[model samples]
Target: MLAPTGWSGRFWARTECSFDGAGKGSCTTGDCGTGGMECKGNGAAPPATLAEFTLAGPASAKDYYDVSLVDGYNLPMMVDARGGAGGCASTGCVADLSRRCPSELRVGDACRSACEAFGKPEFCCSGAYANPTTCRPSVYSQMFKSACPQSYSYAFDDSTSTFTCSGADYTITFCPESAPR
Candidate 1:
């Protein structure tokens, strides 16, 4: 369960994982580097799709969230904020990015973000291009955005990527079905 205050974290899935009878195993993608199934206060490895959330804090009553491909993408995911203020809605990337991922960014079954694939200041939005004004989306980021419009393809994509809610519960799903027409 998530708290109404002082809570901030991310959620993601690990793929191609195999656990032994004693719960010891590893994953090909999004590994937490714990050498076990349990994360145990560890963060996921690169090439992961992240659903990040910052719950309502003392200064605000709104909950902010976003599905980000900034680190990369290992699986399709969705986040639905139900019964909240500020037009809370569903946002995610349902596309199978691994299929269309650029050859250079392809890492096994996952798609690596341009910043991860190419550690350049421009692609990473670092150094001189650290600010939003200078860090515009590159061609690689645009490709990710095109495939997943509701997700953060890179840093400084908050304008259209970030979302908010209040007094609501969230539903996160992996490989969610298509919405009814």
Candidate 2:
């Protein structure tokens, strides 16, 4: 079997493989296919490579430049550390938001809220499990209700919890659109 081309993980391209300018993903979001190119100023060479996707492209009126079609290809993103250019390198590129941790997750957001909504309590930050044990079995059970409620009452070890499903830090294996409305 010629390893099923685009048979396993082939995803649909939002447009003819190109950069997305809309930012909000009104257009392409992933898998730009396998195109390649190199771009530059007017005197630039006739692109030794072609681009696979336009992060923001000539179509969107972003400054035209060349890029490789290969995914994870490294290109010198415009701007330096501290997100500036020239002089002290330490200060430049600091402001570049690409590849940095997102603030929402870095902040206090957690699946615990969703767990509480489902009725599971004290599942995430149970604090100290000794003494009064705020994470008591009752609360733990409640937390599980919020985190994973598919079959919370069952002794079945395979049953899942709401916290397991809604965690942003981890991808919880679940049926798409299976959450309660």
For this target, which candidate reaches the highest TM-score against the unseen true structure? 1
* C-alpha lDDT of residue 72 in model 1: 94
Query: How high is the lDDT of residue 51 in model 2?
Result: 23
Model 1 gets an lDDT of 0.90
TM-score of each: 0.94, 0.17
The whole-model lDDT of each prediction reads 0.90, 0.22
Task: Kindly list the per-residue Cα lDDT of model 1 for residues 32-142, writing each as its tens digit.
Answer: 988899999798898999999999988889899999999999988999998898899889999888888989999988899888888999999999999999999999899
Which ten contiguous residues of candidate 2 have the minimum total lDDT?
161-170
Candidate 2: list runs displaced more than 4 Å. Answer: 1-124, 130-134, 137-148, 151-181
Q: Report backbone clashes per prediction.
A: 0, 32
